[model samples]
Structure formats: C-alpha cells, structure tokens
Target chain A: MGRRSWVGAGLGAALVGAVGVGLLVAPAGASAAPPLPPVSPEDLVSSVMTAQRGPFAGEVEVDNALGLPAVPGVPQLADGTSTVRVWSGGEDRGRVAIPSPDGERTLVSDGTTRWAYDSRDRTATRAPAGDHGGPPEGQQQDPTAAATQAIATLRQTSTVAVDGTAEVAGRAVYQLVLTPQPTERTLLREVRVAVDAETRQPLQLTVLAQGQGEPALRVGFSEITYGPQDPSLFTFTPPPGTTVRDAPARDGEQRPEGDRPRSTVGDGWDTVVIGQAPQPGDGRPRDGQDGQDQRPEGAPDLSALGQPVSGPWGSGRVITTAVATVIVTDDGRIAAGAVPQQVLTEALAR
Target chain B: MTTVSASAPPASRASTRSVAPLGRLAAAEIRWVLRRPRTLVLLGLLALVPIALGVGIALTGGPGDGDGPGLVAAVAGNGLVLPIAALGLALSLLLPLTVATAAADALAGEAAHGTLRGLLLAPVGRVRLVVMKAAGVLTVAVLAVLVVAVVGVLTGLVVVGGPSGTMITLSGTTLGLGEALGRVALVAGWTIVQLLAIAAVALAVSAFTEHPLVVLAAVLGGLIVFGVLAAVPSLEWLQPLLLTSGWTAGADALRDPLPLDGLASSTGRALVYVVLGAAVTVWQMRRRDG
Candidate 1:
C-alpha cells in the first residue's frame, strides 16, 4: 500500500512538469512582451516633414540579396521619395522615381504622382500611388486622400515603440520601432527609425519584412539641410511642340472639371518609335534638301542660330532667303522679329 | 536398365537442373547477412543522424532568421547534411562490405568450412552460383538504403515536423510551399539512385578479391580519390564524370527554379557508372574458377 502511494505521487509530479513545459513552449501568450506606446498621427507627420530638408544630392547606396552589390546614386528623401538613375559603366541605363508621402492633404490638390522614364522607349509614365493600382501613366491617387490613407494606416497597423538610443550620421538619436499589425501583408512588418533626439530629424530608416527570407532594406542620409526649398522644384512644364494627351478617366466615367485636359492629341511626337536616325550615306541629303546647292552656305553658323535646332540641318552650307523668326517666351505669348512681309504672310497661312 | 541409358541428359536439361543449387546458395547468403553485427550498427547510426540534426535546429535559431520552422528543420535534417552522409556511408563503407562479405566468401568460405568439395560434387553450375551470390549482395544494399530512408524521414518528422516545405529566395520572387516540398522529394530520390550506383561499383571490385579487407580498401580508396578530385575547383568540369558528384545533385532542388544543369549531368554519369560496373562484375564472375 505504501509503494502504491509513492508511485501515484511520482505520476502526479510528472504530470505537473509536463504541463509546465507545455506552457513555456506554447506560441500562445507569447505576445506579452508589452503593449507598444500610442503615437499621434500629427506628431508622426510633423517629425517626417521636418526631416525632409536635407542636401541629399550625392551618390546613395542600396544593397539587396540578388548577388548584386550596392548600386550607387539612388537618391532618397525623408518624405519617402526616392529617385534612382540606373547606369551601366558611364552610360545612363534609365530612371526610376517614386514619391511617397506620410499623410493626405486637406485641400483637393493634385495627387501623389510617381514616374519612370525609359530612355530606350523615349517615353515617360506616371505611376499610381498606394498600390500597383494601374500603369505608370495616367491619373494618380489624390494627394489628400493618399495622405489620409497613410495616416489611417499609421493609426490602424503600426504599433510604436521607442527602442532606446543610438548614433546615426554622427548624431545621437532615439531608435524607434514601428511594428505593423498582422493583417498588413505588403507593408513591412517592422521599421526602425533613428531620429536625431534634439532636432527630431530621422537620420536612418530600415524596413524589415519578417517572412521574406531577405535582409532588411536600409537607407541612410548624410549631408542634411533645413529650410524652404525652391518652389520651382515642384513645378513641371511640358516640352515645347510635344502633344498632351488626356489621361483615361477612372471607372470609364467622364473626369470631373479640372481633372483632365479638354483636348488631346491622339498621334504626335510623343509616340514611341523604334529605330536609328538615317545616316548620311543612306542616299538622302544630309539636311533633307534636294541638292547640294539648295543647302545653306558657310554651314549657316547653325551653332549660333539655335532656333530650336534638331538633327544635321544646314550642316555644310548657308542659303540666305527671306527669313522669318518667331520666338515664344516663357509666358504664353508669341513675339515676332525681323520677318519679311511675304515670309510673315506665309507663316500665318500655315 | 539404368546402366543401359546410353548418354546423360542433354546439356541444356542438365544446366536447367543445375540452377536449383542457386536457391540454396542465396538462402545461405541471407543468413550470413543477418549474422553480421556491423550491418545493424550502421543502420542504427543512419537512423540517429536526422534526429540529432532536428533537435539541434529546434534548439538553435535554425539556418537563418527569415526561414520558417519547417524549412529550418528540413534543411537541417535532410536537405544538405543527411544526403551527403548517406552517400558516404553507402559507397565508402556499407556497399564494399556487402560485396566483400558475399563475393570473398563465394567459394573461399566453403573451402574453409570443408563444404566446397561437397558442393562441387552436387549438380550445381559455378556460373549460376556466382550470379546467386551477386543477387544476395545487391539485395542487402537495397535493403540498407530503404531502412535509412524510412527511419530518417520518420524521425525527422517526429523531431522537426512534417515535410512541411522549404523557401528559396531568388530574383525577389517567393515560391509557394507545395512546389518547394516537391523539389525536396526529388532531391531525396536522386540521392538514393546515386547510392545504388556506388553499390554496383563495390560489387564489381569484390569479384577480384577473396580477402574482405582488400575489397574494402580498394572500394574505399576509389571513393576517397574521387572526393579529393571533386574538391579541386580547377577540375570542376570533371565532377560530372565522378560517381560521388551525384550525391550533391539534391542541392539543385534547394535553388529556386531548380538548376537542371548539374543535377541532370550527374544523374546521367551515375547511371552510366552503375551499368558499366554491373557488366564488369558479371563478366569477371563468369570467367572465375568458383
């Protein structure tokens, strides 16, 4: 009877030990590390914008796991804008540009726009924001709406934690970890931000996708400048003589007023064509003139004329005829100069 | 009336009757295999390898940080190390022993036991006897591979988990889980074929030597030389010709969009080696005075 009681006690002890082990290893309740501190959206936006002022005009480096080394001159900014110019040896490969913002705008301004230009294609395309909603060309996500969406994401997905102190770019900084919620699949799982403690400027940002089996994406800034930027940097003017096309309306419905151009050129210089320029030996005149005598004499001093010159026009001669020159200033108006009456009449007829 | 039978049965009928002795010889060979303690020990060691590896992975962080639990376990238990060790165990140790144990004792063991003269007096053909002994040796080799595979996979599943899957990172594309596991299975199957080829080579070597130790040394020395040559990067082009190279063919499956170049070439070489080795063994056995 005594031996039986001893056996029962041993069995009870083993059961308790097994339960303890199960509790230790089980994945449940593993999230008890501590609830991340709450972060206000306004503070995040202000902190990000403040860090946007920097002299970031030099070569930037980016590395990935595809056996490719750090590619140089990949420009990045604090507002999440990036511009990468691809190159091979000394020749330019192409350009990829992305502009990501932290919050939506209050007024209905133009949306966040991103673009990429393939020199080979001779075409530039504007990409949609948020997700891969559409091709690179067309109308983009509304700037205000995009900002609101980003703010909502920050509120819903990100759990902010102040992760102690660190040094970045020779400045003492506070390290912050922004952990994404479980449902945010495409967004990075964690982002480490090193902010200059005193200035509240973000010095470094690292994006980590926990399940990607890849290393973290890191970007660092060096020479930083603060203050207002040149307003012209934000303005865009289309090239002269290039036709503008109305972007396709979203949802196949007519765009609202001021959302699209009224008229569009269906076929124009912007159409991408594949080929090389005709060489001089191709039996065509170098200047597209019928004969050598029709060519301008004394080479026309084409370098000095600079009248929107393209190609080998008047390369070897100058033929002085009734000349008319019309100059279009930066403002939308025409200015005429030194035009014969007959030449002006002809120009007006065209 | 029996004395009046003018001639013995025709040669063809006599040969057919002689094949009956082959069955008895094979049965005896099976008993010899069962008696060897080394065979049991080798199999036990093979079974233990996957368990040890799985335990190690579960305790450590596993192969890398981003790797899932299933992938960490698979890579640690089966993908890289186990297959290589299986090849070495089969080719360098187990296979040569099988050949030497069976072939060296084909006639010599009988002579030592005073049964050679008695067996000679039976209506058994020498060639038929030699073929039976080779069959027995090959059966042992095939059994060894199966045992190792079964125990390794089962223990691996218990300690790590199921053949859940693997993740291969390539060109920024992540493959799905099912596709990755299918590739791992293919790698494991290829490893088995390579091991069988090693057995064939050992069987051929054993046909020439009566001393089991001599047969072991010859077969093991060939493996060592091939291993050294494989290590020399300058001679990498010759890797496809070496039998041991096929052992590493599984590594192709680990790569995203599996690299067919090396795996296909090595498998072809292993097949060639197996066929040639078998042919040579049969030829040698046919001419030997058994």
Candidate 2:
C-alpha cells in the first residue's frame, strides 16, 4: 500500500469515528445546567399558573414507562415515547397533532369551533370550543397544561420545593418538585415541573412513581419557537369524504340510559375515576370506535393484562402501570388512579 | 508506468484525442447502467409494488374494522400518503437492494469484465474514475426512487384521492396540490440521499472485490446486521453509527408544518456514510495494481 492509501484510510476512519463521538457528546452537552437567578418554589408555582401564554409552537415528546400493554386499537394507551406537535395562538386557540406510525390524530380549536380528526378512521368530531373534552391523554398532554394543572390541584396536598435550576429545550428553568405529604396515600413519589426562568412557562413535566429511579411519565418540549403562531393552525375543516359528526353540546357525554354515573372517589394525587366498563354489545356508540360494539374483534383482552385479584369488593382484574393501577370488577365497575391497589380497591368498595 | 511513457508520443496523442471527457464517461456509465436488462427489470418490478399496494388497499376498501398495522392500513383514502407510504415500504429493502446492485455493478462488475483495466490504463486519474462510478450509482438511486414515487403518487391520486386530486396529509389537514407535491419531492429527495449512502458503501465493497456478488452480499449483510443492532436495546449506544438507524426519519417530511429535526440528523448520518465510503473506495483504488 502507498502512503496515499494510508492517508485515505486514516481520513475515512477519522470521519466515521467522529459520528460516534458526536452522538455521545451531543446528549452530554445538553446536561450542563444553565445558570439563572434563584426563585422560591411558591413564586415559581404562582408565576407558572398566572403566566400569560404567548402564541407559540413546539414539538412535545412524552416518555411513558407505564408498562402498559400495547393495545390493538387504543395506541394512545401504549407504553412508549410519542411526539405531539402543538401550536397555541392563545388560551382559546390551539392545535395538537399526534402522529402515529402510519396515521395521525389532530385536535384543533379556533375560539368558537373545535375539531378532532383521526386519519385512521377518517372521522372528524366537531364540537363547541368551550366544551370540556376532559383532560388530554398522557401522550397528547402538553407539559404546560399538565404542570399547571398538577400545581393547581396538588399544591395543598403536597410539599413544594425548588430543587434547582436546569435547562429544558435550551431554556433555563427552575425545577419545582412537588412531593405528596406523609399522610397522602398515592403511588406517585413526586411531580417535577421545569418552569422557564425568564418566561415562567412550564417547559417539562415529569412524574415519578414510588421507589422508581426513572420517571414513570415525562412530557416535555423537545423543540419550541415562541412567537405568534400561524392563525391557520388553529382552524381545521374535515376534508371531503370524511365522516363529520357533530358532538353533542355536552362533550359527547350522552351515555346510554341506565348506565351508572361516572364519579371520582378520592382527592388529588390518589383520585380514582370510577365508571362502568362498556358491556359487550352495549348499544352505546363509543368515541372513535366507528360504531363497533364494545370488545371489538382484536381489541386487547383486559383480563390478559395484569394479575387477577379478588377481595371483599368482588373479583376483578387489576392492571398496574408505572404510575397508576386499574381494577375492572367482574360486576362491570372500572376504577383507576395513581394510587396503590389498596386505594383502587377501597374506591371500588365505596 | 515507464513502458507506457516510452511508447507515449503517438499513442498518447491519439488516445488522448479519442478518450472521452469525464462528463462523457459518466454519462456513458449511467446510460450503460440504465440500459441493462436487469436494472430495467428490477425498476419495472419496483414500480409495481406501490401499484399493487394501492390497488390492494382500494379493493379492501382501506382499513377494516379491525386495527391493522401498515402504511396501507392508515391510508384511509388520503391519496397524498400513498406515495410516501410506498416510498417508506420500498426504502426498507427494495430500494436499498437496487442501489446496492447498481453500485456493485459499477466497479466489481466492470472489473470482472476486464474493462476496469482499460479504464485504469487510461490517463483519467483514479479519483476521477471513482467520481464517475459514484455518479453512475447516484443515477440508479435517483431513478429507482423517482419511479416508485411518481407511479405511487399517480396511483394514489387517481385511485384514492378521487377525480378532485385533493390530498389529505398525515396531519389530518387538506393540502394543496403544489404543497403536497413539494412534500412528496422532499420525501423522494431524502430517500435518494439515503440510497446514496448505501451506494457509497456498496462501491467501497465493490472496489475490494472482483465479483459483484461479493459487493452485494457485503452491503446487504451489513444492512441486516445494522438492523439487528438497532433493535437490540443494549446496543443502542451503537445506533448513531448504524446507517440503518434513522431510515424511517424520512416520513417526517409528510408531517404538517414540517419537522426537520429527524430528517436533519438522518441526513447528517447519511452524509457521513457517503464521505467514509467514498474515502475507502478511493484508497483501495489507489493501492490496486493495474
């Protein structure tokens, strides 16, 4: 081999080696915390809650370590990292797009009208913007919304403290940690919100379960651009041929007659939402089910998921995720919360 | 080198006059590759995959009540996604195989045919020869992706988009024709870059072996190994180095408002492969005895 051959080999080796080092170095570089003035936890919480949200767009990534089975139809409930593209023009104008492997589910709100479209089913649900569609799912929940809601709901029940300052999505942030009080019965150990130091916006939210080294669930902005977003982003119209259904004025809560009313059983941090699991062949038309009966073919069997447990409350299957547990009683009651099995059972017993 | 110089004067003068320019050489290489019956057959066969996929989806009336996992299952009459979905499917194996085959034929096939010695004996520098061959490989990659994309898009628009030619994006928003085509172009362009990276690897392997089959085997085998490594959780540290790591990142082009992060990282990775592979090819060519 000539000297030129050696040189070329060296150059090739050097270039290829750089790629590996770069991948390793890039992530480590982001870990260096940016310096910022310290703020008390109470002030950080209040500022986050009262912050005037400016128009912005960002891609949020949710990492779920909930150990949930990947159900056939409801991919949102699967345990994995999912990305959501969100744009907000203001409080009342917003859009959220969650891209699956082959399809997307988009929800858009434009002050007066709200549209939720699923490309897989080709169905679009239109509703009044003011109608509460309930809290967004874990994957679709933005850090700002989830953090603020947690702070507002769990502040009194938890001990709040400023752990330190860190950088999230290149923004300096204060780490506000909320730990449940000693008497509080909950599965979650602490809820950490990364509040932007300058703008006071919550850039990241992480929830850890008891004794877990890693966060059970984390929702954070991987990339964010703050400015007046494109107004068109907040508006949506179902494409021609899409099945457009008008959601009832009450957020699609028109349940079949004689169904037990849904209720919450506990306070913040351990609240169990108890409801009736739709019975097989129930006449109720479920959301996004395409009018299929309950337990549609290929839908995951709930009994196959966690260990079976029976108690004074009656026999049921208890499925446990990293941060929450769900008990489906044989009698058709479903109770779920971020509490231990005992809390769920007690909720069911009540 | 001494013999050639001693016999230089008239031979060199006549040969120099007759020798084609670099551009002509590259054009000839590309034409030769495109004219090959095997290449044409492969491309014609590749074009059928999308048509088959689209027709199958249309016949089945798109996704069934059951949840099926596939690009076809997610089409739901959104014609714009069909081409992208087709490109995505082909990228996994078919397109890469095509690019690798062309790259193998570029160097190893020529060497096996004894034409490579004539090329080396010519006055064209070793680097120029490598560049010409790389251009040939690139041409094959571009044509392979274009055939799939154009055919798929046409099928999608006519069969699924209906006569309106309207496109619904993966973001669930309707897209204008111009913008939708631009998105498809973006996907097609990104896919070409990925295949270029694969071609570079094949060429590098081809440079070392006289048998084209060896080049094809090495490239495809390496890809399979890379795929396995990417799936292993513990080998995640090796992911960034694997050329196959972010192959799916091209789908991000179909997203609304467009995300460049995934595409950027994957492009950077592919560029690295191109540079490294080209370097290796040049080095081996430099050391080879004419």
Candidate 3:
C-alpha cells in the first residue's frame, strides 16, 4: 500500500480500537444495585408500622368462607366479602373505598368533614367532622388499624406468639400466631398475622373460624406504598346535582366499623356477640345491594325470611349466609355469627 | 513545506470545489484502508467483541447480574440491549487500540513510504487534505462500530431472544423499541466523540514522528498516563479534564429522561482535546519540511 493509504487505514483502525476501549468500559444497562440488608423481626415489624403511620396508599382484600348463603338486605356481609382501598397523607387526611361490582363507595375525610360518594348512584353523603362515617382522622394514616384491632382482640382472648418468618407484599415479616387456650372455648380456631419486621406493620391477617380447615377470612394489603398523597383525595364536593345526605355529629354507637354497640358472651374463637341486627340507613348498604329486599331501595334490613325451628337455643329460625349463620330467636334477639347453633345454645344457657 | 502569510481562500468556494475531489480521495483512501488483509483481520476482531460477549452470556444463561452490572448486564435480560452492551464492551481497550493505530499511520506512514512529498502534490490544500483523511478515518471507525453493534443485536436476537424491543434500564424503568433505538444512536455518538479525541491526539503525535509504531506508542503512552492520573484519588479533580475521563457517561442515555450532567462534561473534555490536538497537528504539518 502507498504511504497515504497506509495512513488512512491506520487512522481507521485506530478510531475503531480506541472507541471500543473508551465506550466499552461502562457496564451494560440493568438493575443490580445493592439490596438493602435484612433487619430483625421486631425491627421490621416496627419499621412497617411506623411506615404505615406516614402517608401511604394501598389496596386490601377480604375473603371469607363460612359456608353461609347470600343474605337478603346486607350488601357486603350478605355476599360474605368486601374489598377496600385506602389512601392517606398522614393524619387528618385520608380515604377508604369499597369498590363493588355495582360501583364504588368511597368515604373521604379531612380533619373536619367526612364525605361519602357512591359513583353508581352519583349520590354523595357528608357528615360533621367527628361523625364521619369512616375512621377518625387520628387513625386515618394508620392503615394497620384493622390488623391492630384483630391482633389486640386476639391478644386479649388468645395466646400471642411468633411462629416463624414470611414474605408479604414483597417485604420480610414475622408470622404471628394467635391461638385460643384450651380453657378459652371461642368459636375461632386461630389467627395468623404477618407482621412486617421493618415497619412493625401487619402486612397480612388470616382468621380460621372454628370447624373450618382453611382460612375463613383473609384480609391484608395487596399493594402498599408510603409517601405523600394528593391532598385533593381528602376533600369532597357533591358532584353537581347528586343527592347529598348530611349526617349528624358522631351518631350514637351506631357505627358498623366492627365497633358497634353489642354485648359479647365470651372471648376468643368461641366469642359470640348478642346485639341488635344491622338496620337500614345505619351504615352503607350491604353489598351495595340495589334494595332487592321488601324494604325500600338502598335500605339495610335486619330481618330475613325463615321458617320456625325449635332448638335448645330457644326456638329460632336459622338463616345461613356464605360467611355468617344468623339465628333469629323467638324472643326478639338475633344471634348472628359464624359459630355453630350448639355454641349459641351454650351462650343462651350462660 | 510552504508558509502562506496571505489571507485564506474563500471557504464556501473552496469547500464546493473540494467536494468531488474530496469524495474521490475519501473513496481511494477507504479502498486502501479497507482492502488490506491486516485491516480485514482487525475489523473481524472488532466484530468479534459483541459475539464473544453474547456467547459468554448465552453459555452462562446470563449470570446473576452478569459480572458488573449496568451496560453489559443487559445480556442477562433482553437481547435488544446487546447493541448498547457491545458498545460498552468495545470501549475499554478494543476501541482505543483501533483509533490509535489509525491515527498513528495517517501521516507517519506516508513519510515512511517516501511518498509524503508526492501525496502533498495533489491540488488539495494541506488543511483540506487533513480533513479528508480525518473524514475517511471517521467513516471507517463508525462503520466498524456499527458492524459490531448490529451484529450484536442480530446475534442476540437469534441466540438469546427476549421481549422484542423493550429494555429495562439500570433504574428499572422500561423502554420501548423507539427509545432503545435512540439510546443506541446516542451511545454510538458518544463513542465517536471519544474515538475522535484519540484520533486527533494520534494524528498530532504522527505529525511529529516519522514512524507509525512510535505514533501508536505515543497514543498508548498518553492514554496510560491519563488512566493513571484518573485513578489517583488525590488527583481526582483532574479526572473530568482527561481525554479518557467519564467516557462511560454515554451509557446514561439508556436511562429515561437522560442524565445530562455526565454526558455534557465528557463531551466537553473530548472537544477540548480534539481542538488542541488538531491545532498542534496543523502547526506541525505546516512548519515541517517534507
């Protein structure tokens, strides 16, 4: 080759070789950043709990299998299930929604007023701050409240102990088992809670009702994130001419947040509650039922059709649903729960 | 060598007149550069870079994170990322050698062949001739890189096919075909910039030397010194100014929204070296007798 050609070819080779060295030094694209170190179970649980107390958003699912048939008037319990989505921006602002097959029932509360919106009917309900239908503002950001309540109740009635470890919602957690003592003849078999070791939050909960092998009820967060939420979710305005109902301030012990005014016969799995049946207009309609019952549309009905049956529980008509068995005693009392009739008879005997 | 104190000729007219002749010169230069058996061997070696990487990854069925992650790690995930991966693979040593050798022989080889004077007799200006040589070298260099990248993409698709076009970034964001293609172009562009730096430096070194091997050694020595300076913790302040500094910043283009800080710094440093090296070469060529 001529001198000039040699120069050209050499320069060409140089360009390729030099660039290969310069550019190829960097590694390829990817996600192999170092992972976080594992923390102890107690630390993880506390961390998750602390994390939940901050702003966060997530979805929770409820599954039930007590072999009860569909109830007449109740919307959620009749179907024996519910799904809830929660969003919060720390205390004083949050929203919890029940996304049903019919539509969505969302209750949002700031520190002041609580508002409920039904996307299906386009009706909005507003209540004074203290009387809000949803959880109070103080507990708004505490998404672990449901699990906390269950854990607290189990602790009071059963043996609370850590079994092992589990992974839930992509975080490592300690598996907490709550078993009723042999002395405690509660209807529940056991309760298992998956507590996050990092945040001390309950990531999952499983309730095994008496007589059932698999979990009778499972409730936990499916997706969860911790951060500030859009503030607008906490505020609600009745969308144009939607029917808006204003509720009085903190209506008497009529709330249905599993905190209703009721009396319990015992504690633990065998625990039975004797209370006035859920009535219409007290809380959101069950199952978002379109009022197929004899009662007015969108109203909660305490009564269900049943033939008379005499039992040691004192002659009552028994009504069974997918999740609960209700026995309306002849004496104006309704004993509705997942417990067997014999247990109710025993409660009556007590 | 002739020194002209007169004002330079009109650039537009000169550029226009130079186009056809420049094209022919470029073609002739490309023919001579590309046809050589040694050149073919070098190109074949360059093409092997991505193939070898792909085969290694394929054989391992992709290691957990595939050695060091980020650019090269894409082999473990998506084959579409292979082009970018190959570019990254080529950059460390293969690229430096290729550019250094080409630049080393640009002028020194002509002098050694005793054809420097005859080569200068062409009607083209000294600057124009230099520009043509640079263009030819750039064309060949870019082609070499393209061959490797394209071959990598094809081989990856063939051997370790993944989701057609989607690639996950280091930050875990997913990109579609369009964006990945853009990223490939950007990586190529960044490699070219760094390679241009080496080319100019080698050319300048060539102007001062009569042996191509010496020119190559100069570039090698220069890069080695720069690498050492960059490695020293106490001298880290000079890293951003080194010709070889932060060349890997181009990989950031694969990240969505494209981080600009590193890319800007690297390109700026490369540009400075390019201008400085080109100036020195021009001075040497203009002053030294043939």
In order, what lDDT does every prediction score?
A: 0.44, 0.80, 0.66
Q: How good is the docking of model 2, by CAPRI class?
A: acceptable
**What stretches of model 1 exceed 4 Å from their correct place?**
A1-350, B1-16, B21-28, B61-127, B162-189, B254-261
What TM-score does the A-chain of candidate 1 achieve? 0.31
Stretches of candidate 2 off by over 4 Å are A1-8, A20-25, A133-157, A182-185, A248-301, A310-316, A327-337, A342-350, B1-21, B49-70, B73-82, B153-163, B225-239
Candidate 2 has a TM-score of 0.83
Q: Judged by lDDT relative to the true structure, which candidate is superior, 1 or 3?
A: 3
- Candidate 1 docks at the CAPRI level of incorrect
- Output the number of the lDDT-best candidate: 2
Error of 2 at B177 (Å): 2.5
Q: Which lDDT tens digits does candidate 3 get at residues A33-115?
A: 22345444344433554465667777776765655556533355432455577888777688887644223467778868777
TM-score of each: 0.38, 0.83, 0.45
Q: TM-score winner among the candidates?
A: 2
Model 2, residue pairs in steric clash: none
Q: Which digits, one per residue and each the tens of the lDDT, describe model 1 over residues B183-239? A: 545655665566556655666665555455555676677778988998896886665
lDDT winner, 1 or 2: 2
Ranking by lDDT: 2, 3, 1
Q: Is the docking of candidate 3 incorrect, acceptable, medium or high quality?
A: incorrect
- Candidate 3's displacement at residue A342, Å, is 72
- Model 3: how far is A202 from its true place, Å? 33
